[model samples]
Target: MKPVDSPERTKNRTRSGRRGGESTTRTDILTAARHLFGENGFTKTSMRSIATEAGVDVALVSYHFGSKRGLFTAVMEVPGDPISRVTAAASGPRSDLGRRLITTFTSIWENDDMGVALQAMLRSAVNDDGAAKAFGDFASGEMMPALAKTAGLSQETVRAIGSCVFGLALMRYLIRAESFTSLTVDELVDQFGPKIQAIVDQGR
Candidate 1:
């Protein structure tokens, strides 16, 4: 029999070749889901397809993630409580808000596991409005309110700030689509952090 070199099959084989154990099962599922979501976009990628790619039963995937949306959330896993971090930085006496904000974002996106997770999540957001809405909902419910509290901005201003940060997150870490990707997190902090902080400082 001839081997099939189709993208799905090839990707499935690549995913399956990794060591087996239930401990790694969730990670494996996430890895496969990320690849699919990144390449095919969220709407096109299905839970069953993810299971097939991972060489696991559909039930297993369903068991772990519960639904396609849930799987996407798992696949796009951003490290740490993004809400808490942003709010904490925003709340601190209005001094060096940019530095704190930059440092916090840097810490989350620079780490290997979190970086991949966050990148995967952003890719979904780029390709799926539902995913984008989910991200917005998170910011609106958790991150924005806290930011508003600390920055003394109205909800509209907070939303705008969230939009800017979301754009930065997508462009820099998720797509890595430009010269910006080459810059170290510290360099990014120095360059972009102050600008972000300025926005919060003005609090318009």
Candidate 2:
């Protein structure tokens, strides 16, 4: 698959200048993008589709947003402090760490706008090498460390626990993977909690 440009790379590349009905046009595009992104996700939703939805020329999307990723960033930005939430999840009794963390992670996606942000981020990472490396760095250097610090475990251990859990968010929400999506949150906790606790217990 061809890589899409990261939002930062194309941030300054937008075509500028006011056109007739520019405000309305931009609003239209944003409205269309929001709908398509919510319904089809970042990867499946195309600039042309957004344009079609907005009844605008495809070039207008590039003119205003720079690229598909740029549009996603502008419109589908994720909200809340995930790192803080992770820290909170890791607090208290460490015995139920797996269940606590899994519940918090799933709540972020299922209950709010964070799901859209994560979906876009995941799709972008899959489609763009730069996005993958950029997010990977944050996951390794930042987010995982918070969980490690709070849980009294090494980053490697937290990552191992995360590796066992985070994928289910993608499978259930993003990929809509069979069987995986069919399971309830409690079912996921029942299945993944033990594996995550196993890693945590190893303390490696």
Candidate 3:
């Protein structure tokens, strides 16, 4: 007859094996957290849910990311050459600049993976001030400056141009304004890019 296993011994074996087999590290935690937060907005996702999704303990999630907000901030930050892509697309042929700009932005927004990251950030921005600041920093630090430089516009003029673009993005994307939705990309360019171009052309 085999010796009876002690309850405490079995518990220890299970716990040790659990960590040994499936311990989640920082990168794993971040990946899991981003997925949950992306699918279910910031407020809806929880540490426990992230751990469950990651197949780790909730404590591990806290240990790695510090808190939900930290994880969220991390999730919002996507690494890319934002300036390079936009400037490259916007650089040549001033006559086609407007079309190029609109098309490039639309293409970025439509890309599935990038779209999830952007939507996650946008959702966070809708509810959190810190997220909004991060979004602004990313745009102002990289995207706006690069775009303005590409267009050869001054700081003040860039601000005006950014405002118009922001207004268009908000109405068309976030708000889904009926008037703006259902319009083709070319139609949007024809209607709005000229207005943006006028500001860029003035540069005051």
Candidate 4:
């Protein structure tokens, strides 16, 4: 006959199993959310569908992310906060701020995985009002104000500067325009940095 297991051993085993399962569950949900969000855009992808794709209970998605918007936020978070990175690039010598911003922005797009994720966010923003609003609010409310404070520029002026940078990124990454896409990051920076600088310098 086999000896009975101790209560403490059984409890430890159960706790370990739960911890492992929780981590796997969260990862699976995020993976499913990213795939669905990319394929169907934010408006169309439902929590139930993501759960189905992840082979998880729908409640798990709710438990993990709270809601679809929360899940999207999680998906979009990069290693270094993109907004903070941009703000940092915009800070310091006003003379070189434009070049710094362009270089930093382009480097982010050149990051293979991050570029794909950002592209998805942009695509969803185009066709979904909610997504568009969220993106706009982030730019206008968070990034614009931070950049304006850093560059010592008026909010409106900073907004225009942001528009130019985002437009360049949109054309190059999302539209995949032949002319824009063909240029190397350095070349694009060389070509557009001055234009951005012009906008930025006006405020100084």
lDDT (Cα, tens digit) per residue for candidate 1, span 104-193 = 777877788887788777787778875666565555555677778776777876766667667788778766668878888778888877
In candidate 2, what are the lDDT values of residues 48-93, reduced to their tens digit? 9999999899999999988775675566355655567889989988
Poorest lDDT segment (10 consecutive residues) of candidate 4: 75-84
Q: Which model, 1 or 2, shows the larger TM-score?
A: 2
Name the TM-score of candidate 2.
Answer: 0.61
Q: Rate the local accuracy (lDDT) of all candidates.
A: 0.73, 0.75, 0.70, 0.79
Tens-digit per-residue lDDT, 26-66, candidate 4: 98988888777666666667899999999888999999988
Best by TM-score: 4
True lDDT of residue 21, candidate 2: 78
For model 1, what is the alpha-carbon lDDT of residue 34? 73
Q: What is the overall TM-score of model 3 with all chains considered together?
A: 0.61
* CA displacement after TM-score superposition, residue 55 of candidate 2 (Å): 34
Record all residue pairs in model 4 with backbone atoms less than 3 Å apart, i.e. clashing.
Answer: none
Tell me each candidate's TM-score. Answer: 0.59, 0.61, 0.61, 0.65
Q: Could you say which candidate leads in lDDT?
A: 4
After superposing candidate 4, which stretches have Cα over 4 Å from the reference?
1-72, 75-79
Reference-based lDDT, residue 67, model 3: 74
**Candidate 2 displacement at residue 93 in angstroms:** 0.9
Q: Which stretches of candidate 2 lie over 4 Å from their true place?
A: 1-76
Q: For each candidate, how many residue pairs have backbone atoms clashing (under 3 Å)?
A: 0, 0, 0, 0
Q: Of the pair 1 and 3, which is ahead by TM-score?
A: 3
